[model samples]
Target: MTGERYPTTAEVVTGARELTLRYPDLCHLGVVGRSRAGRPLLMLTVGNGSRNVLVVAGPHANEAAVGGATVLRLAALIAATRQRGEDDGSAWHFLLCIDPDGAVLNEPWLHGPYTLRSHYEHFFRPCAAEQPEWLPHSGEAEAAALPETRALVGVLDWLRPVLQCSLHGIDVGGSFVQLTSEVPGVPERISKSAAELDIPLERGSSDAFQWPSPGPGVYVMPPPDDEVAVGDGAHSTWAHARRYGVTAIVEVPMWACDRAADTSPHPDPEQALRIAGAALRRDLPLVAEVLRAIAPQLGGGDCALLRTVRELVALGPRLTADWDPAVRALDAAPLPPMTNARVTSIEVYAQRVPLRAAAMLRRIADVPLVARLVDEWCAAYERAYSPRWIPVADQVEQQARSVIAVYEEMHV
Candidate 1:
């Protein structure tokens, strides 16, 4: 497995090709699509089973370790299925690094001492509009889907697998899972693998506050939000996949939060949401101001770096629209005891957004203003939370275990 050192996108594709040579009968490697930056998107098919299970990773660039985990999972699934009875029709496909362009931008931290500082410092995430999960719209006025998206669309259309599991991850937090439809007992079984590795379930992680959860770690997946420019269900990956198979999303963090397991009811849920929202809302304008002052000097840099900086700075008011609504909705929904996790999420939310803004400025880190902001942001995070680097092996193992748990439970 990748262990502590994560694999680059090229290494992942190369590994899959090597595996194909090792197991010619069961493994097939082929290019499915191309990225805007002209990287070939490769998919590795393993097992001879009639029914297929499509697995994808690296839809987001920052989740470097998850991309590494995908390769591990590909190897593990092949070995597991190879040992199973011939009657077991459980084919699997691995889509290696959908965002290869973005992956290149993150290679700086892929082989790491695994500090949050180094991570954000070198991190790069294309805005949502650029992510492959969104399908291209028909109208010329509507943004086109990335080529990676079209390749996936073709794969999904052809395979129409019984299950499509997208592997995702975070830099710091606990394990969180999302499924298009709930499979009985998967949550119970899924939690053990990560927990044993000291990764708690993040009951209060801030990403999908709007979705319903079956338990602390698993959220019932929802369709893409058009408001965010992600197309509606009819045009989104989840919707397209759901037509043929159920979708499972497994998210494991490279860093763990001890407080994530605590489910005690928060004393002030609205307050927590408000504070987190306020900080995020405050960052956009502040970032814009800085860029505005430095605009004359700001020329071309890392396209990934420049894109994120521009998006965050120009992010409209809608950036935090959900935060206040989330605060208001709290009374109606009654916050689910993220007490510890939720409170910690407040700090996480507050710090993470600004860190992202500062992270994009790493291209210009030589600039005194950018360097100071980066240092300040990094220092604040360090002071508030100790850097606890989760091993790549553990993270990959948890992901494998979680996927296997769901696959086994669903297969039955």
Candidate 2:
């Protein structure tokens, strides 16, 4: 078991290979697919129960290691307990480190100070559309189906497991879960695990857009958006929910404090949507202004950092240019029944936007203008965020336990 430590793609691969080799009678390793950068994606199966449970980790580069660690621990746990029929006749599949190229890019800070600053300094997450989990936008022109995603789709088709849990981690906010439906007792198991780990539950507005929650910290999974979803059922979980029994997404947070769990009354969903949309619209021009002022001097750049800056400069407008229209459509949609959970959308965005922007700018710190921008932007973002981080060990352990708890309920 990997415990609380995050590992690099190579480390995860090596560990999986070792486990399968050490427990030949209990588990076997298989190559899932090659990543975009040609790294072999591996899946390890441990158990021989009647039912199949598929657990995926590290689909997103930045969030991969924590989930990778969790699933590995879960595999060992399942192996230990299921010898006594503890898993209710269920075999487990673990997909380790899906996007190796992107994950390797962020491996520098895995064992260290574990501070927000250090993480951002070493972090890199692809835009949502480009992410392996949501790629091949069945119908979009922006991103084609990635090799990693295609492999995952094939696994889903071949196994059609009864439960699919995609392990994910958040940069900010508290812990939350996304389920295809309200699985009986699963929410309670998740809430209990969060409490045991001392991680606060995110009872406020979620970033799942307009998706409604059946209970505190448990949201009903929504369809893939126009930009990210390819067909009617493009997302792996969404596409297979009907054929399979259920899918649960466990989102572990990188940082959380009591404020993250606040359930105070706030604006309605519609109003919160508009508020967030307005911020996006407002921030675009400012981001563009910063890009414009620095563009000419950036032309001589000959590094990945410059290329990312160039992409962001071009991709920023393309990504956010339609906020105004999107908000209008959001306003037109029917509102869900009200609840006391706070509308933390703007709060989350206030932190997310600047923090992420600062991270991007930090990558090109050798450039004088970019370095200056990074300092100013990061300071402003910190002031606005005023975040208190949950201990790293607590966060990682909570996620591992959360998965175990959910899996237990599924077999019951």
Candidate 3:
């Protein structure tokens, strides 16, 4: 648990397997699925009873920190549970590495001497299409279907966990966690945990603008407008959980846990695991608390919002002029300067607002008053610009950037 800097993926997996074997009474480990290249999608279950908490890491290969950390944390948790003999009837299960292929793609950098710019250029920046995790399958292609996706889907369906966490991380800046707005009280608990660990809360994910004075450590990302469910995609594990009545949390570890100051070198595998373990230990209790509070409304809500999001993406280029004024206003307002990153963030927001407004209308199915309010908001935007005023391509690009900002705000 406390030696060396970074551990290789093979080393981490081997260690995890050993832990499961060493503590069979407290843990159940197995291959729930396979990656595209046929590597086992390893899973570990700790504790006993029907009430389960699910954690997933390595959804994207580049973000292997989450998987490594989760494995180590599971080992520690199992040890603690055995010593205490606390049969609380609550179990924690994890899909330790959901995308081994993707993770393997990032193995060269896992050991250390992390270079942010180099890593971004060599690995992370390409769109989902270029990434194994995001590629869609076709009937005729030989390498069409990804083993990782199939394996994950099967396990998720079988387990149907009460609460799920999909682990991910960013290259630059502070640590942040992502959760659905539907999960009430999560933001505060997460913020509290981050403060305890001295990790600054990021107001949003990578796409969001950095605040003028980003407070010392990690911060919570801002929430999207109440009506719109803006996020990566409906295809994500988090979105899948929403469909199946589970509360999901996406943990984004920007850097090692112990190295709070931005000065330290990226942790080696050993150090990274230690950092990850500490974070899960510190934050798990808060996750449990949030789940308890929102149990009643877990999977009961209007799903139409997802459809509206898709429509907005399709209509974005056409909605350019309508959103330009708002974007300009946001830029002019007392906020951070519009860096290339920030510009992208603003565009994402501009694209999402209209979609959210539409979704709000559908949400208030029976409440005429609320529906009327949403309609009025939508109409006002509709009247704000002429169809031909802004080029469709430019509008679409701007909206895309705005969506990124909204995500940053939510993560921070």
Best by TM-score: 1
lDDT of 2: 0.66
Q: Is candidate 1 or candidate 2 better by lDDT?
A: 1
lDDT of 2 by residue, 8-30 (tens): 77777778777777777778888
* Candidate 1 stretches greater than 4 Å from native: 83-87, 137-143, 222-235, 299-302, 325-338
TM-score of each: 0.89, 0.83, 0.54
RMSD of each: 3.2, 4.1, 20.2
Better of 1 and 3 by TM-score: 1
lDDT of 3 at 309: 28
Question: Could you tell me the lDDT of residue 95 within candidate 2?
Answer: 89
- Location of the lowest summed lDDT over 10 successive residues in candidate 1: 225-234
lDDT of each prediction vs. the true structure?
Answer: 0.73, 0.66, 0.44
- Using lDDT as the measure, the top candidate is 1
